[model samples]
Structures are given as C-alpha cells and as structure tokens.
Target: MIPSILPTYNRAPLSFVKGEGVWLQTEDGRRYLDLGAGIAVNALGHANPDLVDALTTQANALWHVSNLYQIPAQQKLADALVERTFADTCFFTNSGTEAMELVVKMARKYWHDQGQPERTRILTFEGAFHGRSSAAIAAVGTEKMTKGFGPLLSGFTQLPWGDHEALREAAAQADVGAILIEPVQGEGGIRPVPDQCLKGLRDLCDDIGALLIFDEVQCGMGRTGKLFAHEWAGVTPDIMMVAKGIGGGFPLGAVLATEAAAACMVAGTHGSTYGGNPLACAVGAKVMEIVASEDFLDGVRARSGRLRQGLEGLVASHPEVFEGVRGTGLMLGLKCKGAPADLVQAGYAEGVLTVPAADNVVRLLPPLNIAEAEIDEALSRLDRVAARVGSDAG
Candidate 1:
C-alpha cells in the first residue's frame, strides 16, 4: 500500500518539530544535537537569524518576479558571488540538479557556438553523485543511480576514481568538451580531492581545451573553511555548481561560469520561472555576506582543526568502530571499520544525528558557526555513540 507521501526515504521514526542552532527538538520534545546540519544545507545553523530576517524582509516587500524582468535581489546575489569567486556570471536555480542541467547545457553550447558541435562528451568519475536528474544520473553513469533509468542521456563518460591515467586519456579525447567533479565529494563519503590532484585537473583541462566544472553544492559556502572547496586547491573551475548552504537552508542554487564559457548561453539559451525569486536570493545574499568574510572563514578553520583533532582522538579510542577520518573543515566523515549504519543508529540512541554515506562512512557536517562548547558537547555525545557501538559488537 502506497502511503500518502512517497516512501522513498527510510526515514527515522522520530519527527523533528523545531530546530535552533545545532539542535533539533523532536515532536515529543526530545532535543538532539544535529551534526549533519540537514546534509550541509543549514550552514549558519538551523533557523539562522540573519537568514530568517532576510527571508522575512523580502517576503514582506516582494516574492516572485519572473526572470523576464530584472530582479534586484537576484542581481545582488550574482554580484556577491562574482565578487567572492572565479565566476564572471551567475545563473540562479532552485536546486543543485537544476544547476547541473545548466552546467551541461552551457558546456556543450560553448562548443557548438565555437563551430565544434562534435565536442559534446563530458567526463566524470566513479563515486560521483551529481544529482538525480536524468542528465546528472547519466553523468555519473553508476548502476546504482542508473539501473532502472535506461536510454539515459548520452555524451558522459565515467572514469575510475583517482585514476589519473584514465582521466588524462579520457579528457584528451576529441569529443570530450568538459570534466565535472566534486572538489569534496559529500555523498561519495566526504573525500577531499588532494590539492595537487585538483591542480593537475586544471592543468589537464587547459592542455585539452576542455572546460572544468565543479559541483560544490555540498561543500561550498564555507563548509570547507574556504568560500568553496576548490579554493583550497587554488584552482578555479570554468563552471561551478553551488547550492545547499548558499541559502543557509532555503532552497537555492546557481551555476557560475567564466565569461568565455558562458558566452554561448545567450538570452534565450536558458532560464527559469521560479529561479532567483526575491525570497531565495535575499537569503542567499545574506549567507554570502556572512560566509565570504575572512573573519568567519578563519573561525571555520580554527573550529575545523579542533574538531578534526578530537575526531582523530575518537578514532584512536574507538578502533573497533572507526578506521579514520576523511575530508576538510566541517565536512568531515568517519570511515567506519564496521557497517556505518550501525554507528548512525548508535548515534541516534545517544541523541546525535548523523548521515551515512558511501564507502562505509558516517558524515559529520555540523554548522559552520557551531560554538566551541557545542563542539565539545558533540564530541562527548559521539564518544558515547562509539562506546555503544563497541558494546553492541562485543
């Protein structure tokens, strides 16, 4: 029997009624420390006052004005993004999936406008989760994501993860016009592509005349202690997808591109009706203003260091449960020696919420502005979860 809502998610039994900062209160009034931060969406913390104010202020003034007309809030967000990052232009969207769709179109259209329509293929890597859209699923080309969705969108080639030789060979192909990757793979278990590797990708793209696209939807907006994860590598993508924390919990996304890369996307090339609505852009502008500051990012780094050090200690003390830690900044993952789901269940018992990802990892993506005391409390709660996991194993 199908329920009123889709049963797509194996949702936890508990229902959260409200959230504040790094804590969520269940319907029954139990408080749980939110280490996942809604899968890295609530970067400033749940119900952030700044974001709330921005949204409400815009809601009172204006809400929806289609892209057919100019939107000041949208322009403001675009200007903020352009000022803070490598993008020369920005196209707003409602989610990362929409951003990915635009990224593909922009890349292929660039070649088409350049009189090379044959160069349509884009290369992606294993363990990559772009989005659930047909183009994104096909870009990843994973059986898990594409099993039932046949006759998938073509022109995307999937390469083995971390196989530089394969990547170089694929990108050098005449038909390959772009390479898409996640600077920090959030769904693929919080794997941070080494700085050197990102640099190499940039070099390879330059040599092959292929555009580089970064999916920063999960690791951007100060999650990696940088404005974006690719900043840590000191290399910029020709096209970048941003979402999740950009709106500090409000649904918003953008595809940012260099002028050269976006040249082909003329007036009618792309657009959206609800994209860049006043409400979303207003909130995103506030998030950008707060997160793109050096002071805030430095705090993120310091907190990340403390949290990473504590996680290292946790790994040492719980060898039976955890293998190691992976990732940078607040987007950390615990590589579990056992099933990561067990650790997640244990965390639930201890009132700490976490997210499980591929590669036997449990992700800890707490709010970027999480307090030092909250960090200590989170560590203590995680320790209890680890102890509980050890007990269950014994």
Candidate 2:
C-alpha cells in the first residue's frame, strides 16, 4: 500500500517501535544503536522520564490557552532561556522552520522600524540548511534544496563559506540588514566555523550595522557540550534560532534575541496559534532545566573527548574509508572518502543508525546523556561498518 504521508524523506526499510537512551527496538525485536538521536532531537533520549512527567503533568492541568492571555509555563521557559543566554527575550514557535521565519522577519523588521526598510538583504553562506520554509529556501537559493522552488523569495545574498574578505565586503554593502549562519553547519556536513572567523564575522556585523543571526537549530541545546554552539567561539548573535534538542524530541522551537533587536516586535506584531502553549512550554522548560546545568555540560565535554578519540582511531585504522572527524560534543560527523550513503547502509547491517549529509559525511548525533558503554558500542559498530564499506568499495 502506498503511504499516506508525502514522499519527503528517503526513509530506510526500518521501523522502530520503541527507544530508550541510545538504542531503538524494531517490531521484530531487533535492537539497533541510534547514533542519529532522531537527527539530534532526542537530546536526553527517547521516553525520558523527566520529559514524560513534564508533558503528562501539563496535559492533565492545561494544554492550549490562546496567546490572547498569559501562559505561566511559557513565561517560565522564556525566563529560564533569557537568564542563561545572550538573548534578552524568547518567542516560542512549533519547529526550527517557524523559528527561522521569525528570525528573518525580526532582522528585517529591526531595520524597517529604524527607517532603513530597504535594508532587507541578508547574507547566507553555501551549504546552509535553515529549514524547508520559503524564507529558508530563498536564503540558500542553492540547486540542492531550492531547485524548481521559485520564483524564489528575493532579498538574500549568497556568499562562499569561510571567505573572510568576502564576508567583510558583503557586510559593507548598503542594503544588507543581517548575516545568517550556523555556528556548526550540521546538514552541510558538520562544518564548524573557526573561532577567529566567527569573531571576524561578529566584528564585521557590528561595524556595518547588520544584525548577526545564528541558526543554532541543529547545534544548540547542549548538543555542543555548551548551552549553544556559538558559545564555543565566544561570539554572540543579535538573534538566535533554537529547536531540535531544546524540545528533547518535542516539536517546539524558539526565537531568541537581544532587547534591542526585539524592540520592534510588539505583542500584536507577531504571534503563533499553538506556540507557547502550556503543554509544549512545560516540556521545553524541563529540557532546558536538565541541559543547562554546569555538571551535565561537563559530562557532555568529557563524552565528546572520548567519542572524538575513538573516531580518530577508526579514521587511522580505515584510511580507505574515512578522512577525519569533525564537529563538537556529541554532534559529530565522519568524513568518508566514498559515499556516506553507502556507509550509512552498511551501518544498518551492523545494527547501528546514522544520518547522512552532503560532502560525503555521515553524522553521529547520539543522545547527550549517552553512556560510556554506548560510545564504545558505537565505535565498535563504526569499526565493523568501515571495514565492510571499504571491502565493498574494493
């Protein structure tokens, strides 16, 4: 039978009936190590006890109260986020795409309210994946995702990634209002923007009066062993988009911004029907609570070092298959010399799940709280899969 859902995902012939921590269980009772963590959404892992309790508690008490009135859970979540990050205000949404919609609009609105309405041009880099929204496709405008999806949304400028000279030159343009970037491009293949480069971009944006937006939708929420990925570079964005792990697998997203950047976004100017609902806010607040602690984050860093070392060893032992490992914390990618898809398929046979990206990279995004034993298992699976891939390619 044909599926009812649209053919959007190139899904594998795998159906997981249940999951806990870093493992998934198929209906036939086969177990698989889940390194993708639902593409970095299951920050604390599937069916997390605390998250379940939070959702259940809210569900019984209140679910959806319209944004027409106050929602205390939403306020508490907003306050928690504001207290820890560079943002002075937090606006909730349903997904990364919605968060991005607000982000682009907020940037443009910032300039418009200041009487520079023509400053709508935003600078985006190559291989950037914001979301499938119209604004997102328009921002990238690349053949990969934006193909046949036009007359594309205008007012975006594309630039080569990591070209500092070009970055400065683009920022200096009169019509530019913002530069949107990911601190570590996840879908673009776990590419981490160097610290100095991020610093340079910050300075350029500050000098040119353009707002800096970090789309941390994939790399935030303690996935990078920090509250947000940009914190590693010690660079802050004027506006930040967060999702995925912040909801800990729930479909909740948020747009965070400096007080100055959000000044024009009055109550009536923007809102969501289901966003900031009591149910989602309660769950998100619980996620933020668990992920925002110093001790928890330190564990993430320790695990990251362990995982990175294991991956490096795999790269050394399988030179024909892998180049190196990239990315930070539990969010990592293995650069393969051959097709990443091939490696991913081979991984399935090894009873491991992974995510594929461009640049022939396979992503490994285990839950932030994955155990040392699970890390060892993932490394063993990678070792076996790498050997199989290398042999098959021969």
Among all candidates shown, the one with the greatest lDDT: 1
Model 2 ranges off by over 4 Å: 1-3
| Candidate 1 residue-wise lDDT at 137 | 97
Residue-by-residue lDDT tens digits, candidate 2, 26-113: 9999999999999999999989999999999999999887898999999999999999999999999999999999998899899999
Q: Which stretches of candidate 1 lie over 4 Å from their true place?
A: none
- Residue 97 of model 2: what lDDT? 96
RMSD of each: 0.8, 1.1
Give the TM-score of each candidate.
0.99, 0.98
Model 1, span 280-350: residue lDDT tens:
99999999999999999999999999999999999999999899999999999999988989999888888
